[model samples]
Target: MLKRRLLTAALLIILIVLEILYLNSTTLAVIFAIVVALSAWEWAGLSGYLARAQRIGYVAIVLFLLILVYSAHSFWPTAITVFLLSAAVLWWLIAAYWVLRYQQQCDLLPNSSPLRAWLGGVVLIPSWLAVYQLHQQYGEYWVLFLFVLIWGADTGAYAAGRLWGRHKLASHVSPGKTWEGFAGALLVGALFAGGAAYFWLDESEALYQIGFVLLSLATVVVSVLGDLLESLFKRKAGVKDSGQILPGHGGMLDRIDSLTSAAPFFLAGLLLMGSLS
Candidate 1:
């Protein structure tokens, strides 16, 4: 299982890197839209819309919203973009509360609840836009940097969890995760961000580098919230995996859950820091 997971992950990384490096922004947007659609499909199942028609309908609604938001972004770039991203940040903050407060006896959303579907939109759309904005405005390397930082954090968490994990971080949500692992993730993410800033920025820009590293660390922390949120939903839904799309990975949702939350928060940080004009 581990080998299959690693192989699948490696292939995915290669494909994503090629897409970011070679594809134009418009083409990448289309591709990302397709990915979001697939994730929405899985999210539909988690949202309790198990029927084929219901899942398709859910995907349609999500795609329609995606187009609507895309059009709004085209017409009013700065205003709509900031609005959606800020909303996403707020939603994640709420989601953090939900995950942390989750209990086995907590009320779960009924199957086919429109609220659950709306929650799907809230979770997926801003992330898609944030990724597109980052790639289009900042360039592929910044996007790559975001991916690398998350990947590093994930790997560090896994390694440290295996080595020294004792205290559960959130056992009700995900019993496998540990506070030691969370620390490892932050440490690795910060180190990578600091190293990148050192090479990319000059000595006179020390403050900027410090801010960048701090932002990266915060992004890593939020990424864990993303993973926990999905785990909470999956547990409530009584499923071990989201879907069987990948060989070892559960589904597109499982693979990109962390990214879904990290992207918007990271981009918002960059914007606030005046990294983009």
Candidate 2:
């Protein structure tokens, strides 16, 4: 498993580098969109949607991707913010809906068995759109930053949890995670991001510097939450891993779970910091 994981990691790093240096933002967007769509397909099954229903949901994802692919000329950030805010709103509603319909929703997570088809597609589309937009709107570092922040944090957490974890972080949800792991991950992520900011961003603007640092911290939080969110979803869905597309890693979802949540938040930080201009 470790060997398979390392091989996959090596390939992924090469692909990411190529995407950053060679692929145009549009091409990168298309690739990322495909990945998210597949994850969403898995998400449908995880949510209790039927096979036929998931097929329909899959169609919606295709259509959604088409819209994103063709609408390339639109004010990119505006489109992204719109999608992100929409997703955020939906996320809130999902949480509220769960709270309101606790009795029906708790045990009825609409697994591949609970498929709500279109609704599941709705939940995932905006995130994919937002992430693709971030890649296009920002620089290679911007895109890579999201992925690396997650990697740094996840790696730190795992290593720290194994080495220094004295107390369990979330014993109920993910027993393996520990507070030490969480803290270590956050520290590494923050340091990596701060260092990146010092070396990468326009040093002339104090605003950019401040914004970048805060953005880095925000990225770390979102990345952590992204993993936790997926874990939460899988826990509720009564599954392990989103899908088995990879040997050691679970799926594309497992690989990009942090980005799913982090991308939008990172963009939001850009907006708040007025870095979008």
Candidate 3:
């Protein structure tokens, strides 16, 4: 399992590096659409709609959204901000529902059936918009920063969880996640973000380090939220893994959840930095 994962990840990393660094933005956008679309498909399964008809509906909605997002002006930043806000609110509402239902003896997601058909619109559209935003508004370094932070956070959380995890971060949602694991994730993610900022960015100053740490911390929190949000859906859906895409990992949705949360986190950080500086 480890061997297959490493091999697959290594090959995919090579392709990603080549795409972001060497390929044209349009080409990268096409690649991003295909990948994110597949991720949306996986999210459908995680959301507990396994029928082909249901999957098709979700996919159709997602595709329509991608078209609309692509056609919009200032799509990148605008779309990402919109996406981040929606995701944040959705998670909050879900959390609130969980709490409220605890007293009422009702299903928190009594009719989440429609969500499977519509959530792809929420999840995938912004993703494509975020890809566009990164490609058009930021340099390759920032784009790569967005991707690496998510990957780093997930890897850190998993490794640390396995090694030194005890206290559950959210036992109801995801039992495997621990506060220790969360701390490890923050450390690894911040370290990776700091390195990316300092090295890729041609600046050498204390302020840069400060920015890196703050941004990295923000990225970590958002990434964790993304993971937890997905876990909420999975628990509601009553599934172990999202799907069987990766051997050790779960699915495309599982692989990309961190990215979904962190893209806007870093983008917002970028905006704040731009304003302050």
Q: Pick the candidate with the highest TM-score.
A: 1
Q: What number of clashing residue pairs does each candidate have, in the order they appear?
A: 0, 13, 0
| Model 2: per-residue Cα lDDT over 107-158, one tens digit each | 4334443344544454455556666666766766677777778788888999
Report how far residue 142 has shifted in candidate 3, in Å: 1.1
Position 41, candidate 3: lDDT:
76
List residue ranges in candidate 2 displaced over 4 A: 50-53, 56-62, 65-80, 89-123, 275-277
C-alpha TM-scores of all predictions: 0.95, 0.82, 0.83
> Worst ten-residue run, lDDT, model 2?
99-108
Error of 2 at 5 (Å): 1.2
Candidates 2 and 3 compared by TM-score, better number: 3
Q: C-alpha displacement of 232 in model 2, angstroms?
A: 1.7
Which regions of candidate 3 fall more than 4 Å away from where they truly are?
Answer: 74-110, 202-209
lDDT of each model, Cα atoms only? 0.90, 0.68, 0.70
Candidate 1 residues 110-137, lDDT tens each? 4556888889999999999998999999
lDDT comparison, 2 vs 3, better candidate: 3
Candidate 3 residue lDDT tens string, 162-270 = 9999898877667788988999888888788667666766565678668867887887887777777677677777787677776667777777776676665566666
By lDDT, the candidates rank as 1, 3, 2
Residue 35 error, candidate 3, Å: 1.7
